[model samples]
Target: MYDTILVPTDGSTVAEHAVDHAIDLAETYDATVHALYVVDTSAVDIGLGTEQVDRIRQGKFGDMPELEQRARDATGAVATKAADCGLDVTEAVVGGQPHGQIADYADDHDVDLIVMGSAGRSGVRRALLGSVAERTLRTTRRPVLVVDAETGTGSD
Candidate 1:
């Protein structure tokens, strides 16, 4: 029932599974898959001093380019995999919080569905550290299909 499926990846094993599942769904529905990779800005702020942050802002850490390239590569890989499955695919890499970026993409692109992997953290852990999937589900207007990471069978 989907026309355009948005699949956001983070290069994690769990996220890869989400990509595979999204590809399959796209293929089945004759939908176009839009693969996205978001660089989590929050991760870069963890445990960083002012000087470290300044250096990072100045591109001295040597990690920024690599991270951007990784995101691009991951998006490309997902698109390629979907194409190999005989599905139409497009890819993009965006910066900022994963949830925000993904939601914005869905809003801007007329995406009919979002397929993402949930890390499956619960109770205390989930409360302490929120989840991207949870946030996206709360904010996005499109239908979302969350693949549980614990199942480990998305590729099949």
Candidate 2:
């Protein structure tokens, strides 16, 4: 029933765990996977891309080198994994609040499902820091499959 799937990755080990699920689903349904990386401009301490840090310091920016690397690394990892499964994949990078960006991407891209980790590298800090998966689940209309990194249970 799914034609398109969205997997939001932060290049974390936890997020990587979810990539398998997204790929498996794509393989099962003959769906295309979209890997998205959102550079959280809210937590920028330094600019990665060559540009005015002061200018980006005031607003959302995804062109920073550090964030760009994270995006490339995250999306690249997804692409590799999906490729191994013989699944079609696309990658994108954007800047915004994590949950909002994910939700917006799902809506704008006609995503059939969202596959993501239950938590990122933040770990237990999630209780205090909140979760991108949780937020995206709350904000998006698409069905979300949250893979548990520790247990690796999401499929079926």
Candidate 3:
């Protein structure tokens, strides 16, 4: 039933796990796979979380070339894997709040399904970091398949 499946990757192992799921589903449905990597401009003020992400966001452009490249690399990795499997693939990099951007992309593209990963945090960690997958699930009306890092082949 799925004709378009969206996978949002942050280049983490958890996201890679989600990519695996997306690829399998796309193969089964013979659907197009859309790989999205959000820059999460919101994190810019807070130092961008990771070292690589921080370095990229600090570049010259309003949304730096480095930042876009990182986003592309993340999406490109997914695209490459999907394309290698003979699946139709589309890739995009955008700067915004991650959850909002994901929801918007899904709605704008009329995606049938969204497969994503969550770090499954709790108590203080969950409270501070927040879960993009959880926020995305709350915002979007579309179907979402969440692969939990804590329970899956990924570290929280």
Of the candidates shown, which would achieve the greatest lDDT relative to the real structure?
Answer: 3
Runs in model 3 lying further than 4 Å from the true structure: 45-63, 153-156
lDDT of 2 by residue, 11-46 (tens): 887888888888988999999999998767667645
Cα RMSD (angstroms) for every candidate in the order listed: 4.3, 4.1, 5.2
Give the Å error, residue 141, model 1. Answer: 1.3
Each candidate: what lDDT?
0.81, 0.81, 0.83
Error of 2 at 152 (Å): 0.9
TM-score of every prediction relative to native: 0.83, 0.82, 0.84
TM-score of 2: 0.82
lDDT (10s digit) by residue, model 3, range 1-156: 999999999888889889998999999999999998877766664644565454443332344567667777888999999999999999887666889989999999999999999877899998888899989988999999998775654221
Report the error of model 2 at residue 115, Å: 0.2
How many clashes in each structure? 0, 4, 0
Clashing pairs in 3: none
Off by over 4 Å in 1: 45-63, 152-156
